[model samples]
Target: MPALLIDRPTCPATQLHSARRLIAEERLHTLFQPIVSLDCGVIYGHEALVRGPAGSPLEMPDALFAAGRAEGLSMELEIRCALQAMKDWSQLQRPGKLLINMSAAALSQATADGRWQRGLGICEDYGLQPTELMIELTEHERVADIDALRRGLTLLRRLGVGVALDDFGDGRSSLRLWSEIQPNLVKIDKYFTRELPAHAEKLQTFRALLQLAETFGAQLVAEGIEQPEELRVLRDLGVSYGQGWLLGHPSSSGASEAAPAALQVLASKEIAVMPELRRAGGSGITAEKLMMPAPAISDQASHEQLYRFFTEHEDQHAVAVINAAQQPVALIDRAQFISRWAKPFFMDLYGRRPCTLYANPSPLIVDADTGIEALTRVLTSADQRYLREGFIISRQGRYLGLGTGEQLVRSVTEARIEAARHANPLTFLPGNIPLSQHIGRLLSSGREFVAAYADLNQFKPFNDQYGYWRGDEMIRLVARVIGAHCDSQRDFVGHVGGDDFVMLFQSDDWEQRCEQIVGRFNELARNLFDAEALEAGGIMAEDREGNLRFHPCTTLSIGAVRVAPGRLHRAEDVASAAAAAKRQAKHGALAVYVMAA
Candidate 1:
């Protein structure tokens, strides 16, 4: 039947006619790709991609949409694509939601043209409720009327139809659009997902965007994930949904479930060794680290566009207008714009004028790479205006995102909590939390490691005799010794607590390092003690029984456990096994025990 359609068009002149005939003849077909839940390993939904008849000139979506746009029939063409997908998806009897793509222009036009009503009718015809469908906004065409688009989407969402923004963080995707539309899900661009394990900047971007998603009460769908490593990283980032060839390929047969191998990857307990933020030259955290989703627009845009943008994005406190060079030109406060816009004759006089008429051309605009510390010291940075009306965040004079005093303070506060988890205060080494976290990364990466548990012996009695201040000095001595012996590049040394430390050794000479650590700690142990305790060979202190007794001087006991790949499922399990080995080492004469786990 498809063969009866016109042969692939060879001339540009025939493209429009071919598109019209393609729609008239109902030549479009739908392909479904399963979007799977990263956390639960279930099929979340299927995105329906429309294609023209096989071997036709319009077989590819980009060509087909281009033809439609060129012919001024995009609204008709998009409706046909969506309605056919709905018809085919209903026939496939697939569970979960069915997602269809629509250009913002077409969506806005559909509101008054009744084409959307026809789509709703198609859903009902298939016994599918409005809730079963999701309209994903594609960036194929620019949106000319922001208010119309918002109203159209609002109507659909009101009727239980889900809304999403496709290829987010790509092309002209605006944070203002994100804030204004409040999509149920945002499909992250493939650029960020590709080779994600090697890109720390991408990881940090996703982390910030994830926080933005949470703030808006929406989920993120990482798209174009073609590697198991990418999928693992997305899972670690707590992304809700994922769509890519790694999970399932788009097929005409409409495979609604993930493939067996992909399912296995999802079900695995492996944690991704997520790329960590590395600062060059010990640079402090930059302004980029604290960025949330704030949208920017071109200065050439009209005031009506700005007005509609503010009306749609009530949650957004501010919007930045950038020049053609992508440098920020002005900042628009939501309240200020709306208040001025509400005045009598304001819309009648300036609705169509350039938005810069009302914009603050001298508003705060900071480079994205500006250090967070420098930002806090700026005059009036502590003022309430920036908290309510955010400033532009740019990189090399080009807009990157937005920031505010409120989020800056919040980010610093949150970072302190993370800093505490990453390192212990007294010892200033990696803390217990990072100890387990690194173990998990090693186990997931299939790397062999030695888990060395170090404990200070008779430390309570020593503390009782010398007091906490002296005990702290003793603990510091142990930390210094342990840190000095291990290869900082390949091994992790963590101060779990007072007198207790953990080392995950990836070095080949781990055993030698352990022995050196024990010898070094014992050598330094005497210096923390007074002459009287040193002369007595041990200190007089109460034991666990609370009886006054002569206790041995503080000495370090080292327990080493060799952990091979796949020997443990959980990092905590490895930790427990190592701790068990430590107890055995404490009883041994050598004060160091090495055993396979």
Candidate 2:
């Protein structure tokens, strides 16, 4: 047998002295761990984690912070760590938000003495705006004054700073604090994320927290995601942002690298999943994800200057020309510029002139919000010259980056293929596979909305009398009516199969919208029958029991379920509730029933 091992605790004096020396000498350092956006597969931000002196007793973060708290130096240590982290981050000048950890005690103290302003001042000195820095409140210690903390956070917000609640679901009062503070972001604790794919309870808990965050208008970040399985599960659950060792590890240097190979593969797989999740309507991919950062030249730059830039960067296919307002005016293709300059007597004619003379007058430009499919349509319709020149991606009419026609084509093809596999053939609406995923996504997003399930009452008899073709027309007609009533940008309308359909209403006036759909559907459905059937108000057909009978014209019955985040956790639960409501609606002719909360 191995020898027995016993651990000894450090003395109070020793711990206190270590903490004091660490603060006095400023031996603390910060390591940056990248937080990635699951939706776009890019680095959303970098969270700065504090580190103690190497080979010292307080090298670990828990030991350092705990020691500081024991020795009454928590506030001092916290401020010094934040200052050092910001200073290090400033040196790298990386784009995206910088997340800094702060304790409740430290925050309360900083607000009291106006030290928080000094922190913001340091940030400004480093050329960072308040909006770019996110102060993450760690739950190491209980807050003494909740009201004072809120006041401090409100003041910070006024300065354009973003606040985040860290390690949520680990502390007893986290839920209460979230309700009172309404932070801009919430990070779920590692306990919930670790081995999440295997634990049903953990997954359910995470789903609940996701809903809670959505209800508060706060974005959720999953922490300590070390496994690809965990990442996949989170992505499927519609978690928008996450940070984990699997994506990237902490680095002393400020360079936050791209996600690892495994994660890249997972990100690609996520794109395929997007079409299924968004089948009811939106594009899963946006221009922002496809854009590549290219050098932008001032419109006033001389041709000689532009030539030199192209010569130095052999890999550059195109460059953007921007005006004084930083709006893209034209895109200069490298080959065109080089060929023009290489012509005989070209230098003498225009070498000294501004590059704008050679710039394409009408460069292709697209907004970052443009969907990949829509962008493809624009590209395919454009002249061949524009396709070779590529297009500039912009946000709010300002130049962001450049995207090549090649990338757009590839993305569009993949999205189209994925969409075709899941689309319903009869009505061309998204099928049940996408419907279930969409419902789960909505619930995970934490927004309270309405889900309405529609079934055509007495559809079989009408189909029996009118033949399959007319039945198809009737189903298609109902789909058109539902689409007309829905806000295409906000609501999701899907065909579950046969005469059944589902709609997710996110608009504030969902009740009125559902009523409108019901009323319109009843009116439009009548047109599917002939004048004789309309006058008789019935179709002669064989009933399900094989008995001859006169069936009334088909009518629509809708069961609407109002979903509150915490109350309904799964898509299956929502479906069951909606089904129950639909049963009530079918009891009456041309009716809708919205289930109570």
Candidate 3:
């Protein structure tokens, strides 16, 4: 207000004049948009937006900033906007913290000769602490010196001011910048967060971004989330913060709370659906998911450094040694290295040598993309050294992380248990829930399979005469016969309660297998009956109409339904079709009946 304006422009560009006047007179408008915490559903901070006078051509942020930038007033204009936003924020006592954008050019230049104090002086004049401010790096311009920018950001962080990288995945967002600056927060671009539920590619990309954020120890702030689905996804994906119209629109009066719609989404108790685990080339359960982020060292590092690292950090059980190409070539167990180094004068003699001399060059190495199920099977055949040395997981031949045999074993057991949790207590086979899930997966994958229903003929009459003791044995015999005949890898056998079983076959020899089961079962079940009943060739049991009749020997019957891809979509539909085929088989004379559904 005291006329600290820059020199007037020579050209008659009204836009330049408008930009200067707004900065000089302190008449620039500022709106505040809330960046809410996705976890707590509470306001985390407000991003300050600077605009020109209402209804003016320069009122838009792009035009207004362009005008200032053209006249070489970028730094001066940014400081003025910061002051305006800060002054308003303090007056209104906004909740949480305040975020203001600083162009890369301004931020890097300010660190050259301590010009950053000018921005600090503005904060001091407004009676606000640096802790209440967050500097967002705008990507509108490239930094002349990134080192200077990093220094400036470090100074701000030391002074209790947080730093953020804005609109990540666009513009200046790069791995170099991310590693060098080490920002406290990263605001994701709109492209990944908008209508996230409808875009599969975006969903997977966002998941990888979340992992990257975790690796860098930075919190994620999803920008431009306008839909309810987008908010839920970000929240479920473990994003820390979010901003969009759905959360709260930009307002002249700072919004101090969450929007009603966002509150509703946060109120949901149901867990969000996760992205599919089974990606192409691997089952969803990969070694990467189970691998511990165990740190790796270069093979060129000295043995003394490795020893000291292990001594200082006791949690690491082993250290991997990678070559110049970042490929893991060896593993050093802490126990083994420490034992060897503890010998008298061992460190003095060998500590100066490369650590690779003490490492196992042939450690178990597994590709990160390999399915954990396959890894489990491989480990089952591995020598005892696998348990001692653990394993290395990599992707594209580059080291990713380290995994132990214990971790792999535990994960596979848990996955198997979780898959068939609803299993039959008697036979320990999958029950109805797992049966449906398997059928559903096969249908979803468009795989052609044979759905077979297995039932014992004259089972009820046998149970009534032989009592529950023999009856259970009869059922067990049927389960054993069916299980032994089917190919375990290509077939799924489930018990659908008492004398009823479901078998989903992917093998080409399913019909022969079914017939074998029937033939083998008929021979085994005859042993359960008494000699008198066998000699008489029948038993006197009440028929369905309540009259006594002769019942023949108990035999095995199987009803088979051939399912083609695209013919059935639902699990219930397939089950019903298979059941109808079984009923048809029951009225026939053949031991194994086949039909299509």
Q: Report the C-alpha displacement of residue 8, candidate 3, in angstroms.
A: 7.2
Clashing pairs in 3: 277-284
The TM-score obtained by model 2 is 0.44
Summarize candidate 2's per-residue lDDT along 298-318 as a digit string, tens digits: 999988889999988888899
Cα distance off (Å), candidate 3, residue 494? 18
Candidates in order, TM-scores: namely: 0.55, 0.44, 0.49
lDDT of 1 by residue, 90-133 (tens): 88887898999988987887767766776687668778788999
Give the poorly placed runs of model 3, Cα more than 4 Å off.
1-5, 8-17, 111-115, 275-278, 282-597
List the global CA lDDT of all models.
Answer: 0.81, 0.79, 0.80
Task: Sort all candidates by TM-score, best to worst.
Answer: 1, 3, 2
After superposition, the stretches of candidate 1 with alpha carbons farther than 4 Å from their true spots are: 1-17, 280-593
- In angstroms, the error of model 2 at 526 is 59
In model 1, which residue pairs have backbone atoms overlapping below 3 Å? 176-295, 368-394
Per-residue lDDT of 334-452 in model 3, one digit per residue for the tens? 99999999899988999899999978999888898778668867656746576877889999999998988788777777766554445665676767776787788678656689999
